[model samples]
Target: MIVRTIRADDYPGLNRLHASVGWPQRSPDGWRWLADNPARREIGAPEGWVLVDAADRPCAMLGNLIQRFVLDGRSLYGATGFSIIVPPQHKGASRPLIQAFLDQPGVFAHYTLNANARSASLYGRLGLRPWPEQTHALKLSWTIDPLACLHGRLLRRAYGRVSAEAAETMGERLMNRRLWRPGPLRLPHGVVDIRDVSDSSPYGRFWGTLSEQGALIADRGAEMMRWRLADPDLPRRPLLLGRVEDGRLTGTALAMTAKTSIIDPPSLEIIDLQGLPGFDAIPLLARTLIRNARGLGAAKVRLQALTPDLLSRLGDLARSARREGGWGHGHAAFSDEAVAASWSPTPLDGDYLMCNRPVPPAAERQWARRRAQASRASKA
Candidate 1:
């Protein structure tokens, strides 16, 4: 078998490999997005590396996303592995694919989120040290009935209709709970207004301002926002909220409905949150997300606070919104000690924000049409 960087033409084979492992198949738009992404070229490789047999059939693939940041007064690089697939026949391909990723230069660190025990052991042997601090800081919103949630999970595993109804009911109850609801939209005396904005709005400005005041954060400027938020295959459009005072954007937050394997009901994930020095806008932002999530029928709101300061502030905000602290983990590995020490990663840093959901028949047809149009355009 030969291991090599994946190219656009390899997506069909990759999709087949993904299916063989029971992973969600990528939409045609997803494959196109991967092909067109500039980061692929920036990393001097495609979205991943694939191992192919003598007949040129792909047997394994490791996918990643490269994110650049300024850490400790210098430019730093990181890549997060999003997917690794190897079938029983291709078991031998895993090591070589991982080794090729490790050999890539210029990346100061490699990160993975929510790795299973077996994968963790393999990564540990390959020099990836787990950063537990990042893993321990997740905050959860809304109260859930554990038994109901469990029933939903079991039903879903068996592909039962009751699962959908149960999940929806659980979501509605979680949102309708008085504890999860903030009485009204109330801003402090200085805060002039709170409202929704487009993801491509001036929120990037607020992100930049906060980056200057806080620790090193992944680049989430206009370009990154467009690339990440505008994916057509995304199950839900990100909700963007902003706080303004005297016509200046003081704070911003972005949330999306996401499905997780471990969680029975879908969740509203807070992927990005930025506020001015006092963190005055966080509580309001949290309230708005909870309210909107209720409309989206999401069971909970999830937040990741990477730094101690953000963690404390978010914890307080969650408490104000009557949210509970739950056990969730985020993991990272670094090549440079200093960069790793200063680095702060949010759920938005990598492909973690992209959650797979079952597509409705109508949506699937729409995607099929779009795929045909894209193929025609490409051939032209």
Candidate 2:
């Protein structure tokens, strides 16, 4: 088998392989993003590799992304998405693709992938130790709750009532089509008022701002967000914008209509969920969403969450697969189920502050001490 970097001409083959293997293959927008991405050349197809049989046939392929993030006051990089397209039975061809990934020096301190136990064993054999990680899924079989459906209707009416013109303009600008309604639901305790992704005030601005920070790793700007959120291919995907009374975006959730393996009916899966510091609304959100999905005549609501908070909160819902973080600009799949099911803590060298290990306890204490001193000095 020939394991090597993928070329520009190799996209079709790679795409085909991913499709055959039942992976969430790239879309046209993703393809465009990859082609024009500055990281394409650096990490080899955005830290991806392709393997070919001696006949030069594309036998197996995998892609990895390295991302930089701050965790526990330290900078770290995480390597993720070690996607393999070759069937598990093709042991010879598959080994090289993963081997090529590990061969890179200092390329990853930790690594992750969305593989089941069988595939995970291969990673363990290759020196990629497993961390406690998870992915979650929700089966949308329950009928939509009448009350929740009414609430969504009321939210939409309230939004429209705010100004038919504003609603119309936003619909055109954001292409929002979720059946939302303004409500006075007796929300549970700590159930903060979740702002609609369409809320035009501080919520929208906050989202744009946070997205900008996330985009800095890449060279793109507003155009990137537009491309990501408004990709024509991702229709019926609700982009939620929410905030608390303190004007902080407490929770940002997005749901997209899609099919699932667990259920036969259509369902809306949460692609992403972002909450403010110390606020974990995923379980509540998941429960609410499940109720809502039943109300929507769907079977389930699935969410992919990888944050530390959700990982701990919904640990029980975790699947057997392991998911590593990846670098590059792509759609953020934030869902409670996905988070619960497939979150791995493999650290790429550049993605997290403590990518290699949970920040050593001593280091964390020292950092905390210094931070406290700095705060005291500022007050003095």
Candidate 3:
């Protein structure tokens, strides 16, 4: 087998690699963005590296998400990996591919968010340690549709017992509602659905300050934000609730629907929450998300891996669901432990595909057509 830089023409082989592992096909545009996007090349990093067999057939592929990072007052680059796959017959192909990602020059850090638990020993040996516990250790969640929550659980016969107990003892919605009563927001104009993320807008201005905090963080400026919002595999657009004042963002929250497996219930997730320190609009966005979750008919809303400051501002808004330990491992190549611990990791900080279950664009289009036909029939 020979390892080489991934080329734009490798999309088909990569899809085949994913299919061999029982995973669904990824979006063509999305795959191109990872392995052939201008962002990767502009940073002077390989698009990605691939391992091919003797017949020139690609057997394994590991894609890269390389981006600029600011750490301890120094401007540098960081690399986070995505779409790593190797068939059983190929055996031990993961280490070399991962090493190739880390081996690049001018990189300050190398981390991954979707690595499996079985890779813990291997990752440890590769010098990629677990990320801080501030976000990864605990998960907090809120229930928007208690009936639907209880209903889906009952079908799974798994987490349903807890819901059944809550139903019997506390009554549905009582515990969640009493924790915090969030009212509609209006800081001079209430919260607005962030319709524009142009660099001159408040959304872009907000990330500008965050990136300069002089800590370990992914590029969150307009360019990357725009790329994420245009996710080719996203089922729909994510909701961004913002409170702006005098052309600056005071606070904002972004919510998206994600599922790791087909068996998982539809989840409305709060993935990014930060703004002018001490801004009080988090609960307002939380309220809006819960309201929206109901509108979308989602079962449960989740708060995943937010920074400590962002998490604290919510203040008992959601119950602690479970502990999510160590899906990430990396060490800072330039900065120290203090800088590494400061990174506010959301799914946004890593591959968007980490939490997203890719639904082929064709399938999505077909579903839209069916909905339109149903609407026409109803009018008739």
What lDDT does the true structure give each of the candidates?
0.61, 0.43, 0.63
Q: Give the alpha carbon lDDT tens digit for every residue of 29-48 in model 2.
A: 65555445333334433546
Q: Evaluated with TM-score, which candidate comes out highest?
A: 3
Give the TM-scores of the predictions, in the order they appear: 0.74, 0.54, 0.76
lDDT (Cα, tens digit) per residue for candidate 1, span 164-189: 33443323211222222224433345
* Best-to-worst lDDT order: 3, 1, 2
lDDT (tens digit, per residue) of candidate 3 on 1-380: 97888876787898788666545565778666555444566777877789998877788988777766666556556677877887778779988998887787766668765455566567678877655444544556776667756655564574322332242332222112211222333333567888788998878878777666655766666776677677665656777788766666777777766543333455667767666565677776776677666555456777655557656777666444433444443222333455565666665666643335532233334445666887999999
Candidate that beats the other on TM-score, 1 or 2, i.e. the better one? 1
Question: Cα RMSD (Å) per model?
Answer: 9.5, 19.4, 8.3
Q: What range of 10 consecutive residues in model 3 has the weakest lDDT sum?
A: 171-180
Superposition error at 354 for model 3 (Å): 6.7
lDDT of prediction 3: 0.63
Candidate 1 segments whose C-alpha is farther than 4 A from its true place: 71-75, 132-141, 144-148, 156-201, 261-263, 304-307, 317-329, 355-380
Report the number of backbone clashes for model 3: 2
In terms of lDDT, the best-performing candidate is 3
